[model samples]
Each structure stands twice: as C-alpha cells, then as structure tokens.
Target: MDSKTGAAGGAKSGPRVRFAPSPTGYLHVGGARTALFNWFFARHEGGTMILRIEDTDAERNKPELVEGILEGLRWLGIEWDEGPYHQSERTELYRAAAQKCLDNGSAYLCYCAAERYAGGDHAEEEGAGGKVRRVVRCACRDGKPTSAEGQPGVRFKVPLGGTTRFQDAVFGAREFSNEEIEDFVLLRSPRGEETAGQPTYQLAAVVDDIAMRITHVIRGADHISNTPKQVLLYGALGAEPPVFAHLPLILGADRTRLSKRHGATSVTSYRDEGFLPEAFRNFLALLGWSAGGDQEFLRTSELIGKFSLEHVLRTNGVFDRAKLEWFNTQYLQKLPIEELLPEVEAELKRSKLWKEEWASGAGHEWFAKTVDLLRPRVRLLPDFSSWSRAFFSDEFSYNEAAREKFWKKEPRLPEFLGQLAGALEALAEWNHDACEHALRGVAEAAGVKAGVLINATRVAIVGEAVAPPLFESMLALGRERVTGRLRAALPAVQESCKA
Candidate 1:
C-alpha cells in the first residue's frame, strides 16, 4: 500500500514503521510495549522497523536518557533496521514543511500573547455547547498580523466544515470534526518568526513519517487524539498519511493509566530486577496482543509468526505483576544448569558466600550440582543466592520459623539430629542414597518416623523449612558442611525448644 495515500498501490515491499520515543527519561513499560508491537508487526510483515528519537524539545531532553532508551530496547531484544534519527538533527525539514504550509495558505501567524490567558479574562469567550473556550483561534487568517509587539507564532489553519476520518488498524473507523480540532500550533514563537520550538509534534511527526516513507504507525491509544491533526498536516503537505494502529492503553490494577505509582515504570528496572529478557518480551507481547487460544508462553520467533494487528485487544490491557513473575519463572525453568551457574556464582560472590575453592575441580562440580538442585525453586535469577543460601556458605542464617516448628515441636529433635549427623558423617558414600539411608537408620533407632528426622535434618543443613528436596539438598551441601551445620544448629534448636 502507498503510505502517502493509504491506498493499495505498492508492489515493492512490506510496511515500514518507526518506534519514535522521546528521550525525556528511561524507556517506560508503555513505550517498550509500543516498540515491541511495532517490531513484531514489522517482522511479521517482512518490513522495516526504524528507531526514531523524538527529542525536539532540547530543554526537556536529557543527553543521558538516550543511552537508557537504547539500552532498554537492546535489553528487550527489540532491534531496528534504520537510523535512530533524532528530531533535533532534522530541524531543517520541519522548517521547510512549516514554510510550505504557510505559502499554501494552510497555516497563518497568531499574535496571541501569554498574558491573555490570565485568570477568568479569556473565559468569557464561549465555545461549543456554550462552554468557556480553551482554544481561541487567532483573527490573522488573512495573512496579516494584529499585534506589532513581537513576532507571531504559526498555527495550522483547520479547514472549515466536514469531518476527518481514518480506518484505524486496531480500533476500526475513527472520526473527528474540524470544529473539534481548532487551529492548533505548528510553531511556537512569541513573535511572527521561525525559531526554536517552531515545529510542534504534529508537524514534525508528519514531516518525519513522509521523509522516512513510513507505511504504518503503531503507537499507544493516547496518540489517537493527535492522529486527526497529523492527518490534516499530511493533507496540507500534499502527502498521504501512514496507516494508523493505535494500541490499547496499558492500565494499572486500579484501572487507571500506568504510571510511577504503578511501580517500576522503566523497562531497565525489570532488567535490573533479574527478569529474563525473553520472558519480559513474552510478557510485553501478551500485554496488547495474543496468539489466540490458551498459548501464553511463546518465544520471540513464535510471536513474530503469530502476531497480527487485527488480534490486538481494543480494551485496555491490565499490567499484572503476578503474571509477569509467572513468565519469569517459566523462562528461568527452561534455562540450563550451566547457564544459571555463572549468575548464581556472581550473586554468591556479591553476598560474600563465594569461596575461591568453588571455582575449580570438585568444588566447581558441586557448585553446578547445587545450582541444578535449586533451579526448580527459583522464580528470578537473584533467587539463586537467597534460596541456595546453605549450599554456597556455611555461615548462612537459619530460618527462625523453621527452627521453631521443626526443631522445637519435638523436644528431643536436637538430640536426634545430633545422632543423625554422626550417622551421616560415618557413611563411606556421601551421596543422596547414603544420606537417605543414614537418616532412616537414625530415625529407626530413635523410634520416630523417617519424615520427622528428615525435617529436623533439613532445618539443620539448609537452615530453612522449604528447599528443593531432602536427600538432594543434603547431598549438594556435602557431608562435611552438613555435619558442621548440624552441630552448629543443635544449640539454636535446643534454645528454641526451651523457648
């Protein structure tokens, strides 16, 4: 289809779209989701996805924020084909377009001063439905200036009569009357001069889309209000507007628009919080579009094949924290033990649980085994350090609740655990089988069920009531550390039992 005309006339290739983000701060989740949708659409249609930085407002655009947006995109696995064109670099294009609009009588100069909006002075002017007008069109439509104080600002002359309509890819047909969209500003200057802030978003966006030959525009639904104005600009420039796909707004649990109060708005925060990139991408995919049926966990490649603009939900998608964690857990479960080891080791080192000896020989094998044993219980990468505490360090703390329930419930638990430790230490083989046998032997001698001794040993060796498995956890901790922790924990158990 021809991007300019929105007609089916193209035979060269597929749609071309761009993910334009303002570098005001870190790439928020809403922006990231928009990028993902655009990426998936481009990939699915065999088109191009361009990264455009809408940093036209130099005063508000921070140089440091560009890197964060790029990092967030890279982390989310959303790559682009063309330039990360910054609007700051394209001032000439916007200036030329504004001049074209002015020469064609589609735009005029406005001499409205800032002081005119002071207090209730401007409220007397009535608008539609006899309400106080917020936007007052300038009386300079005849190419003449009213005030000689300073240069006037340029405003796009909204064509009189009729309604502007477009077929939205996601939301279907949308219409806006010319009366509803007043003569909005194309350039902001106190005097009638082309200066900085001359090209507003509507003008700059239309100019960039035409220059880049973008065939599709997939953005948040909030931009729906800006679409008609942009379409009018395109018509004024004698260029066709691109196909518009306004995605549903993402909302918080409270059903309001997602924001900082919604928690961790930036995509990098999720990256920093141990969320796997693939998992996050999957989560983002599900935010607005679905693959149909009960299929939730999907790879990026799979999503590309299944993603369709038609399937995008019209209602606002709720950002569910539990659902995202579920995706993270699923992704973590698919990772191999070796892949998880380095991260686990690094976390261990950071928490002072890492022993230099574990980097080589049998210690390395033990570390890998420990990670494998603990992987089943992990939800995030950081959980390796917290959940596998007893595996990497001998000085890890015991769970007070476990100490109370498992150790204190049986007054003779400390005595039994001490005997079980000696039995475990005396074993020639310190594997899972031998560990289970030793515990059962001790339990038989003490006239208690094997489960009772197992629970006590779990509290002693792993310092928690919940771990992977009894025999496997003990085997991963090794017999020496197991017996040592048992001896160390006996006094704490005795004290807790007395309490």
Candidate 2:
C-alpha cells in the first residue's frame, strides 16, 4: 500500500477511521470531539469505525480507564464496528514491527546514557513549560550499531532532505521538513526490577494503525505536529501511510483549551448532568464542523447523512456554555417521557432522593406525574430532582423570604390554607383540572387574586418560588403530603406575621 493510494488501491469504498485514545484518565472534551469527527466521517462514508485504546505506557495506563472510554463513547452514541483494542494486548504486533525495522537497517538500538541525552532534567523543564522537547542524539549513528542486548533504546532513522507533506481533509496541505525532526525513540528497556520497558506511543500507534488497516486517521489538530513523525515511521516499516484529517481544537469561551477549569470536560460529567446523548453529540459535532445552514441540532442519522469531512473547520471553535444549554433545552423538551424516565431516576439516585418503591411500586404514578409537571420547566432532568425535592419528602425546608413574603404577610393565609387543604382532602378525582378548580375556589372566597393563593400554596408545599405549575404540583404531591406541608408552614406564617 502507498501513502497516496490507500488500501484497496485508491478505491473510495468509503473510509475506515479509528479513534485511538490513550487510557490515562476520563476522556476529555477535546478527545470527545475527535471521536465525534471520526464517527461522523465513518458513518457518512458508510465506512467502518474502530475504537482502539492506546494503553502502551504502563505507568500512565489504568485498566479502569478503559470503562471510562467506553462509557464516554456510549454516552455520545459513537459506536464502533471493530473493537476497543488495547495496545498492551497487542504488544507482540509492535515488537514484530520494531524487529522488522531493526532487521531492515531502518531502525537501530542505541546505548546512550540518561545524562548524555538529557532525559530527566530536560523532561522536567519541558513539563514546566507544558511542552515536551525530546532530544534524541543517536549514539549508534556512526558507531556500527550492535545487535544490542541489554539497556538500549530503539530509534527510527528518519530520511534527510525534502519535506514530509500530506493533504489533510480539514486543514488542507501540511508539510514538515526532515531537519525539523530527529531520530525518535521507539522502545525503551524496562525500568522496574521485573518486566521489560515496552514500545513507545509513536511506535505503537503507527504499528497499530497499519496493522488495523486504518485508512483515515481523524483526530484533533493538536496532533498535527505528530503526523510527520508517524509518517516517517510508516516509511521505516515499509508500510503505506493513512489519510490524515486533523480536526480543529475545541477551546473554552475564554479562548483557552477546554479543561476542568472550563467546567465538566468529561462525557460522564455531561451525561450525569442530564444531557441527552443526541444533544451532546450534536453539540460536539458543531464545535468544529457543521451540516451548514442555521441548523444547530440534528439526530445521529441526520448528522451522518449530511456529514462531510471537508466541511470541518480549520480554525479553533469556542465551546459556548449558552449554546450547549440551548441545545440541551431543545432535546429535553423533545424527548419522550419514556426515554426521559431512566435519566430522571438516575439523577434522583445520584442525589440520594431515589426511593425504590417510588420507581417500582404504587408511587410510580406519582413519579410519572412529577416528571410530567416539571418536564416543560426543566432544561435538564437532573434539575427536576433538585427542584422537586419538596414533592418527594415531608421534610420541606421553606425559603425564608418566601415564608415572610407569601406565608406570613397575607392575613387570611391560615384560613385560605385550611379551606384549600379541606377541599384537596375531599377530592374524589385528584387530577390537575380538579385540583386547580378547588384551589381557585379557596382563593376567590378569600377575596384575593389566584396568584396570591397560588404563591402561598407553592411556598407552603414546594418551598421554592419558581417551580412547576402549582395545581399540578399539588396533585402530584397528593392530599396527605400537601396537608402536612401546609400544617407545618402555619407556625412559620404566624412568626412572619408577628415580625
């Protein structure tokens, strides 16, 4: 296979792309965007998408982080056709590739001491500056490279003269001169008392991509600099290079890279916060690429149908919180009640407000009613759990201001509450319309506006000024709980009157 002509001899039978992420931590928002672009490209072209976990660095790799990567992908609805392949599992493949390069004289083992190559000290300096500049002064360049048994690092011999150039689908043509690059380390001897140090990421990734038959490598623009190195490795292995597309970086609103400081960069964090998978995918897809037009929301199928790798932007795009919130609201409203139930339940469980009986027992109807009442008012399902707290538990803590303003000041507050409670208790049909009529009668008889009675009742029950509709909230809360809240609020109302 040639770099210009991919596998299948330049035949455009769609393109196979892979999202190769190192399992170091939770998948960051930047990595999520790369995954989305790769997913979009694969689906759009009717190609295969693979999820490869590049867990080559044993120190940094955690077995648990594999679940995080899969969870992130599942939450974003980015499915892969192949595997969640781990590089550690494929060590033999990388070792074979390295051996082939060594046997062909394209790679050699060097016995350079740590001090001579500036390892620890240089690594520290680069860390402080938030960049890595590895100085690989190859000791085996002219010394007639040995078979190299113990304590040696492998280095690829990069070709001198001319530039390594490739056409990127998003950033257009990119070229890097050979002088700008040095012979990089491919493998290092084991450091610990046990086990040998394995192949580096630069080597492992190139070998894995080629072995996996990845046709197009769709990833972030931050990795654009590493492309030439991998291209050089491809040549060293006597293998063809894959088509590369470096999608733009997603920045925070402050124009910095998206990180924890920007708030909730992980896919699990977003999902836990009640973002729909489709909406999250839509938000991620629009961060650097778009289907064109005023459309900001799209289903996975719609996105796949209209997606084009060439339409992806080269410039960095800011991750706007407002825009994501807007997208969330859209999905929140459009989602069916059945689809929204599990999310609502999860949020409740996370908040420790979840009751098994409420989800699985006679309380099921009440839970459904609660979701229905708050669905329109909420932008996220997690919001309903926090906001609708008073509905679930009898331990309602009223807002002090709401107690003073609505509960205390009104002279006929107790009388109105008593009548409303009595009417609610006598209701044969405890539905929205019936409850609204009964509550309104109490307000009319008290010679006050409906809002006055509604406000007082809401504060008495829900303990918050802003909530779902008053009557529906009361109906969902039930007669016993509603009366109990009203009775408990009486003393607070009297205290406010005295004050």
Tell me the tens digit of each residue's lDDT in model 2 across 1-499: 2231124333446678899998856888899888888888888888888788888887657778788888888888788877777788777777778888888887767666354343321232364677866653454654544334457667777766679888787888889998667777787765667354488889988987887688998988888988998998999888899888888888888999888898888888888778878888888888878787888778778888989987888889998877887888887777777777787888888888888887765688768767777877788766776667776666657887677678655777877787888888888888888888888888898888888888998998999887887877877777788888887777776666677
TM-score of 2: 0.84
lDDT string for model 1 (1-499, tens) is: 1232232333438889999998856899999999999999999999888888887776646678799999999989898887687787777778788888999999987666564322322234676799776744555655444564566667888877789988799999999998777778887763335454457788888898988889999999999998998999999999988889999999999999999998888999997788888889999899988887799989889999999999999889899989999998887777666766676677677777888888889888877777777877888777777756777767678888887778766788889988988898799987878888888998898899998878888888888887988998876777788888889888888898888
Q: Write out the backbone clash pairs for model 1.
A: 4-240, 151-191, 151-192, 152-191, 152-192, 187-198
* Candidate models: Cα lDDT each: 0.81, 0.78
Among all candidates shown, the one with the greatest lDDT: 1
In the order shown, the candidates' Cα RMSDs to the true structure are 4.5, 5.3
Return the top candidate by TM-score: 1
Q: How many backbone clashes does candidate 1 have?
A: 6
- lDDT of model 2 at residue 447? 86
